[model samples]
Target chain A: MLLPYLLLGAILFVLGLIGFVTRRNLIIMFLCTEMMFQGIILNLVAFGRYPLKGAPTFDGQVFALFLIAVAAAEAALALALVVLLYRYQGTLDANAYRMLKDE
Target chain B: MPPHPISLSALLPELILLVAGCAVLLLGVATTAHRRRLAPWVTLLALVTAVVVVLFEVLITGRATRPPAAGSGLFYGSLATFVRIAALELGVLLVLVNWSAGREEERGEFLALLLFALTGLLLVAPADNLWLLFLAVELVSIPTYVLVVLSRSNAAALEAGTKYFYLGALSAAVFAYGLSFLYGVSGTASLAATTRAVVLALRDPNSLQGGLAMVGIVLSLGGLLFKIAAVPLHFYVADVYQGASSPVAGLLGFVPKLAGLIAIFKIIALTGFWDTENRAVYWLLWLLAVASMTVGNVLALRQTNIKRLLAYSGVAHAGYMLVGVLAGPLAGKALATDGVSILGNGPAAVLFYIVIYGLANLGAFAVLGLLRTRGGPCETLRDVAGLLRREPGLALLLALAMFTLMGLPPTPGFWGKFALFGSALTASRLTGDTWLIVLVIIAVLNSALAAAYYLRVIAAVLLYENDQPAYAAPREAQSIGALLCGFLILIFTFYPSGLMRAGQHATRELSEPRATAARTESPVASAVDPPFASP
Candidate 1:
């Protein structure tokens, strides 16, 4: 059962990494990255169920909680920037925003 | 469990900082919204008090009959002191430098974030548990992400902030997932225990999970390397630096990088990667370090924008610092005792290198911040032409910064690279590892390569004619900043004995006793100006 869940997460993560690298839509790339993070969190909580029996077992769960919090904060800030990007350039395509291109 | 760890007495300064952060938050809410300059002032006061308290603790502890061990307290020992002092110093500097940046409304949030970030850096080195490490990393990062967006006026600020957050979060997630795998194998987050478990797990052929876990740990470190703007993960740095406002860029460049470096050091120390027979981790660091050094330096050569150039330059230096991590405990021995073993002096050299790098880098940025134009700010290298004619003193400071970056003599950057290169050469000789020698060669060559661009800025400022329109000149405050940073650069070079002594002392206490005693009695340890060992 654990193996199957782990395999599923690996699939999702790879998919997210691929989309993030391949997709040119700035918003979609962000979504894919978020998906990658989510997959990691899923893997963590699943493995955390059987933490060291008597040694404060909630470490993984606590870590997961923190991850979610950071994810929320990141999303809030990223979305705000997205709004600003569209306002500045009138588009959200990664290819279109070449102001900071490698020189 | 386990006697509730240890007494929280060792955590006095951190506790004070925590209180200060809360007080600043409350004050921000209570006071008039526009008059938020008070927040930074309050944060500054709190940091001062915290620094004082830490000094008191250090004095008290040092005098004690039995000093606390490495793993004592919630977090105790000299390594804790080194980490805390570096973080706190940078934190104070960030607040001082960024004091006038952004609008009045944003200052409060900005200071609050900086204070919170410092708190995170303070927690990282002493973090015995994996949970603490993760928490500390996040605490440092979250506020920094907010700081990237604080400059409301710049379109680049908003874009940079967004990209930074997205990538930073993605990396943090990667770190967490890998951490979970390690926890599963060890059934504990204590770094020592985790290392033991990793060793046991790695030995078994059937433990594919354990092998995967090792990969996860390495992968997670990629996120941290990103924060430090090290190679491969260095993609975000130039853009972020270019996009963010000057003060914000300065903060991003220094404070977070320190935090990330400390985290990297702590994790490596806990894992005892130095003792392990597997050369895999060392090889990985070597490859990354070389890439970071070569790529960052080569790329920086063509940059027209000063900040973008510095950004790449900073990445290359991070690679050099990682060399110390690869060199490990004997470098500590070299610090605690020098030249006893050819293979081990790299760590002490690295520690000293970081101090010099931090001071020089911050001083450089502070000067750059002062050079604003009517077009808003002068980030491009062309803007600096003929600056020496108009402002000779300021131009000199820029030259000093460039010289330091190039690791030329008398500057801290040179001494920094010299110490590490010395150790790298010796280690390579003893171990017969040609790769280590190659790294040293690359490092030296890169320093020479860096001189081209670094000198170009100076040459343009001093020799080239100014064609760009000169608008309203920098005010009194800007010049003051320039003068202060310039003085610091000069002072670090001129009176190197005290700081070098302090750095040597700090490195001495960082490792085990056998290494310390062996190192303490060496000639190189005592000799201040010995050139690297003969080929």
Candidate 2:
């Protein structure tokens, strides 16, 4: 019974990883990371609700809460960086900022 | 259950950093005109105070035979004290370096962000729970992303911040995903409890629980490899280091990297993952060490840009540190015998190497910051040419730092590399493992390869002639900090025993309890089940 929920969470995680790697737009890439966070949150909540044995514990749920908080902080920073990049380069494309590379 | 009174003294250094950081932020707004002059002093005062507090903590711990009363909750052990003190001392140096090098406009924000990051680093050492560990890691990372952009408003700075943020975020997610799996299998977030659970699960290699725990370890560590700038995750380093201002780049080089190493060490200690029967983990770290050294050094050899060169060198250093990690007891079958432990030596070597590397790297970057042209900070090998003629003192300081990085004798870098490679050799001897001897050989060759590039920079400073006039002299504050770092490097080189003693103390404090815990737990597990003998 717990297997399906775990499998679903794993699928979401892999999907998020794929999206993050394949997507070129900076904002989209960040959103994909968020998607990955969501998947982790799902797994945490699922595990909290159903233990492998005995009664359910709140450890996983508490962890998921902290994860959400940290993820929010990360998102805020990511957006600010994105805005800074756009203001400087006038594009959200990752390839647009290559001034640091070696010739 | 009766509520436990929280020990505020345990959190003294971090609390000081937090209050000072917030105060600096407020001061930035209230006294804008005076901030450029006032902020750095305040930051320095806060850092000094925190350092004093850490020293006091260390002293008290040293005198006491019993475990510290304050060691129970968030803060635990002398390792925490040592790591915190080391990190805060580096923070003070960074503040001094950044004081004059950072633009006047962002002085307040710069100091404040740096303190916030230090607070995160300070929290990382003593974090008992995975939740706190994750939070501390983020706290360290987020402010750095902002600081990367705050150093300059140039396109490169912004791009560096963006690239750093994206990769950092991805790594954090990967870490979180791994943690969730760990939580699912272990059913707890406390590292001690989770370790027990993970060991039990791993006793059955074919079980679903065992498979999940292995996945969790890989995924979590895989994410952390970004901070260390190991291969496959080091692609962003050169660009980021080059984009950020030199002082910020120096902070980038050490702060997060040190925090990550300590955090990883804590995880390994708590999870006892190194001592597990899992040879896969050992092989994985071995592969990473070899790859990072080869890739970092070889790529570094061709780099014209000094920042890129240092960035790759930083990668290579991380590889060297990984060799120390690989030498740890986790990789082998040897456990405690006659209570004379070899387990802590690997971590001790790493700690010692970090202090040496931090001093040298920060000094080098400080010199780079000092040698700025009207165009901007010196970025290429050619820029440093004729430095010997224009500024002999700065040229010599840079040369000392370069030689230290190359691990030449009479410099602290030589001692650091010796200890690291020596520990690996010891571990190999203990385990009768030939792979570690091979690792030591690879590391030695890589250091030689690294010398080729480090020498090139040194040669440029001393040999090449430039008729162009000297750029503006470095600011007094930065020159002083650089000199102090150079002096410390020289002093530590001649008197290396003190640093080695402290490193051994920190490592012993970290591993002793775990050793005892394993000893007590193993007997019970072994008596009940013949197949599940604890290593």
Candidate 3:
């Protein structure tokens, strides 16, 4: 019964990882990371709801809440950085920011 | 479990820094003059105060010998005290390196962010709570992302910040995901509690669930690899370091790397360690140590940019430190036949080495920040070439850093490497683990290979003479920081027994608790039905 939540969370996580790796746009890549965070949140909450053996506890739920707060903070910072990067390079393409690397 | 994992007094120093970080922001609001004079002072005052408090706790109060209220998320021991003191002391140097960097108008935020990052780094040692550890790692990271951009106004800094943020976010997601699996398998977020769970998983390695349980560890470690700039995830180091201003690059060299390694050890050391039965865990680290050393050295050889070279050097150094970690802490005095006890002290060696590496790295970067070439700041090999003619003092200081990094016999860096390789060799002999011996040979050979690149820096400064080495307006504060690192390394080289003894003492209790726990070999069996009973 709990297998579906685990599989769903796992699928979302892999999808997000794939998106993060393949996408070139900065905003979309960050969104992909957020997608990854959601997968974690889902997994934690589901595991909390139906634990492996013991009675359900709030540990995973509490962690998920903190995860939400941290994700929000990351989003706020990510948006600010995106705006700043957008100004200088005038593009959101990850390829545009290649000036720092080696030839 | 009823007793709070974190006590008020336990976190008093970090609390002080946090309040001071916020106060710096408020002081920024007061007036420009107030901030210019007061921000750094406030930051330094808090750091100094934290150092004093930790020393007081360890020396007078005997926090070191106190048995950890086991199952408490924080370990109250000499290790926490020492890591706190190191982070705080290094923090003061960080302030010195960053004293006049970036825009004066935004200096308040810069200093405040440094405090926040250090506070996060400070918390990593005692934070055995999975949630707290994750956030602490993120806290160190998020501030650093902003700090990179703040350190310089150039497009390159922006690009570095952009790459660092994206990759950092991805790493965090990967880490959290790894942790979520761990929490699922263990059914708890407390690291101490997860120890029994991890032990059970290790005992049943043939089961499929055993593989799943171990994935949590390997995946989280993979995520942490980014922070330490180890292979597979170390792609960002050179770009970020090269793009950041020199002082900030120096800051990058030490803080996150130390925190990541400590957090990884905190997990391993707390979990009764990746013991002999776990060949996969051993080999994984073995592979990382081999790969990081080889890759970091090879890529660094051809780098013309000074900062990029240091970045690769940082990667290679991280590889060296991994040798100590893979060796694990010396289990007991029973392992001793003589003074060779030093060989088994992996945790202590890493703790000692990273700080020494930080000092030398800071001195190198401080000297680099002091001088600039015609095109820009000291960016290339030729920029520092012939520095002996223009400035003998700075050139000599730079050469000292190079030699130490090269692990020349007479330096503190040599002692650090000696401790690491010795630990691996001792571990191999004790466990009959020939792989540790193989690791030692690889590390030794890599150390020799590393010398070629480090020597290039020494040769550049002392040998070739650039006719027009552009000098930045004298950055006296930064020069003092460089000189301070050099003097400290010199003093330690002459008198390392004190530092070595301290490293050994700090990890003494760190190994003892886990050692007894592992000896019991009945963690899961002792517990009542329902497996993990959340009291």
Q: Which candidate achieves the best DockQ against the true structure? A: 3
Off by over 4 Å in 3: B4-6, B65-72, B274-276, B331-333, B336-340, B515-535
lDDT of 2: 0.79
lDDT-based ranking? 3, 2, 1
**Would candidate 3 be rated incorrect, acceptable, medium or high by CAPRI criteria?**
medium
Q: Write one digit per residue (lDDT tens) for candidate 2, span A1-103.
A: 6788888888888998999989889888888998889889989888777766445666677778888898889888888777767777688887777787876
Candidate 1 lDDT tens digits, B96-174: 6676666665666677777888888888766656777877888888788778778546677777777788678777766
Clashing pairs in 2: B274-B330, B275-B330
Measured with DockQ on alpha carbons, how good is candidate 1?
0.34
RMSD of each: 8.5, 5.0, 3.3
Superposed on the true chain A, the predicted chain A of model 1 yields a TM-score of 0.86
Per-residue lDDT tens digits of candidate 3, residues B1-535?
1342345777888899999999987776666585466887888798889989888887897666344444455655667777788899889888888887777788888888999999899878777667879989988988998899889888888888878888898888888888887777777776666766777776777764576678777888888999999998989999999889999999998889888988788666544564534667777888998999999999999898889999998989999999998887753244644634565788788888988999899888888888878857886888889899888898999899989888999999999999899888887787788988888898899889989988888898899878896465477667777788889899889987777777777777566645433323322212324333443
What is the Å distance of residue B440 in model 1 from its true position? 0.6
Name the Cα RMSD for model 2.
Answer: 5.0
DockQ sort, best first: 3, 2, 1
- What shift in Å separates residue B162 of candidate 3 from its native position after superposition? 1.2
Please, what are the lDDT tens digits per residue for candidate 2 over residues B1-535? 1213347766777899999998888776665586557878889999999898777755865531223332132545667767777898888889988886446666777789999999998888777567778889889999998898888767788788888888999998888887787777866665666677777876776899888888887888888899889987999999899988888888997889988898778655644655653577778889999999999999999999888999999999999999887777432224434333333367777888988888898899889988866566787898888889888998999999999999998898998888788778877776788998999999999999999999999999899998862353548888888888899999998998787777766666455445433322321111222231221
Which one is best on TM-score?
3
